[model samples]
Target: MTFKLTPKQEAQVSLISSDATHIMAYGGSRSGKTFGFVRAVLIRALAHKSRHAMLRYRFNHIKASIVLDTLPKVMELCFPGVADNCKLDKTDWYYSLPNGSEIWFGGLDDKERTEKILGQEYATLYLNECSQIPYASRNMAITRLAQKTPLRLKAYYDCNPPGMAHWTYRLFVERRDPDRRTPVANPGNFAAIMMNPKDNEANLDPKYLEELQSMSESMRRRFWLGQFADVTDTALWTLELLDQQRIVDGELPDMVRIVVAVDPSGVSGEEDKRSDEVGIVVCGLGNDGRGYILEDLSGRMSPADWGKAVVSAFDRHEADCVVAEENFGGAMVQEIIRSASADSSRKVGGQVPYRPVRASRGKIARAEPIAALFDQQKVSLVGLFPEMEDQLCAMTTAGYVGSRSPDRADAMIWGLASLFPAMTKQNAGPNGARSPVVNLGYKSMKRKRA
Candidate 1:
């Protein structure tokens, strides 16, 4: 069977065919990197009768993206009719190839599944979308690459580059100290090949190229140019700021008031349309006068589902009230929460206290004071919330630069505002005089124009 490959894909294939033990193809979206690498791994597995494994951060993600989407496409393109004989064991999540070789796929999320998958040795290993996998887990998998086979003991990794602070960037791209941003004195046998959307232009739609070009600056840099461009300078929150305020789990003080804040998505009833996530965050104001972020229950769900989540968090945290933003749905959001609470199997005595707050100002305007509280060491996170922190770190005065809505941050703001009214309300004289300048010494507030 004759099949054409893009230049970038050919380069990736050549890398896989080379003597390199550790290889990475990192780049932009729809760059054919994943397809090329999958094809290369399949070819290797077919040529050499040995066990191979493909892994991702989540098992469902591996099944949805690779097993269901990419793997079949690759087999059809490279080895026509080979899938007819390929036996897929749904229970084990592996493909029994026509040849003696077997391709096993699993995720690191499930401990039992991971142990089962890694119990056997393999000739080759592929870590798909490896950027999402933590460095420690990746290191653990690297130890299992000692398969005894004539085929070269190689590992293939591919991802759209994350932040420069990511281990992938330190291990492959810079081969240096992530903190100091300096080259390593002794680097390992790793090679990183980067390819952008333009590299696979012939295989992509022209409209897609236009869309890519029009992305936000931070997104365009990472997705289009395949570069690790830092947007920390523009962001309101920094990792250092968050880290300084991070407390050990179960170290929270007595809470005077706890609130469950909800940021309802506009498309609550529209199942067909793509909607933003329902941001549900639990926060408490301790007796010590410090704000503590308790939990982040943010998710993309229907109105009924998210409503249940909000009430669940409220009961789980023993929250005093449920504070919801009414800008999008008016009273409908509160009604959803009340209905869900009333219908819940875990019946409480009475209806949970629900307070609806209207969003009159812009998101950034409301978020600025909440961020200032963090700067003043008045707020701390009870535990690490990676996804929520990611959104918080992406928020800028200009607005959130991330592709999706900053719903998590919005929930945090709502909760914080309820706990500390001064954070959201504008200061004024008793008789309507000029607003007093409250110098909180927050850099974000200081940088604002007069």
Candidate 2:
């Protein structure tokens, strides 16, 4: 069987088709990446048919549906002679070669399952959609393929750019030095084959490309153009939702129970100068059940300086309790605030206490559930803090960490969550104590797309 290669696929295969240790094929969707890599693996396995060869994907089910089901149809067109032998079975996602070279399919869902197949030395390893597998799993799979001898073992990893934030991308794609790494036109040495949608001009449907162009600017940039989307883009929070009438400033309303959120920085003196601003916000719920952010004490300062500032926010707002992100400084942040309150000059009342919650999730994930509350009209922001507002508006689909200015959003999450602890009950620890979901400085969580 002979399948025609798109110009882009042909170029990429030319670079990687040889006696190489590794071949990295990365490109946009429908670039014929999978077919090219699969063809190489199948041909190599046939060359050493007596040995084992396996085609793997993120999961066995996908391998069955995609490779086992679709690949043979394409193979029939490419190699008409072997079309009769290409059979899809329950466990195997490939076919049987006449030379005792049996093509099998496997999934990399868990280490235990993957390890089960590692006992046999594989003549060729085909990793379909390599980006889906976690870095840890991919590395383990590679190490397991230690060759027994002259059988010759080679592996091919196929995927597209904007790979999952998995460690695989950092180690392979990002670290590959084009200058030092000798480029091969075939499967010889470690080579990265680059392909763009336009490169496969002959096969791609014109309507599909035009449809991509018609998408929203953000969507086109991320999905079609293969760019990283911002944390705020498509985020649940939007400027329009933060109704101006809901924003309250200057002084918080009388004792509906106020919460002050603190994001304390551990750095001191000159070191603190370059660090992010330690944010402190005082907020409270109103009679109507809406939330109000009355004061902001956010800026870069030494621990002592920030502690004092936190105390001042508590005193000024007569805050009911202080909620602090305790991941870095932990209990020490509480101690600092307590010590600052005891000082004669400050004498902050009620000890300027710290909740000391430790964060277990990313900034966006933590903020997400809270953002839902606001979206559902369960929480309301009082008088807009423009700086905080700016950060919220700039947040993209990736999360707030990308922008490096999650302070305002972080402070807001902590302040609101303190009053509504039940809001995050699902993520609570074994002891029923909630993880530090919010603090002053916001850290973003990694998100996976379908």
Best by lDDT: 1
**Candidate 1 backbone clash number:** 0
Per-residue lDDT value at 205 in model 1: 100
Q: What is the TM-score of each candidate against the true structure?
A: 0.60, 0.49
lDDT value for model 2: 0.60
RMSD of 1: 13.2
Name the runs in model 2 displaced over 4 angstroms.
1-3, 50-57, 92-94, 148-151, 163-168, 174-189, 216-223, 226-450
lDDT of 1 by residue, 229-310 (tens): 4646567786546645566422456676778999888655436347788889999887678889999998777788888888
Which candidate leads the pack in TM-score? 1
lDDT of 2 by residue, 1-450 (tens): 336777776776676655667777766556677767667666665566544445444344445545555567556666667756545555533456766575556667646656666656666676765544445556666775665645666777765453223333444555533334533244225667666566665777998777656654544543366443233336555543453124221333344567789876645744566666787888776544556667777877787888777777766665656788888788788888887786433243546555677777777767777777776666655543556755665554575533465676688788877766667764466799766423332111111211
lDDT of 1 at 117: 87
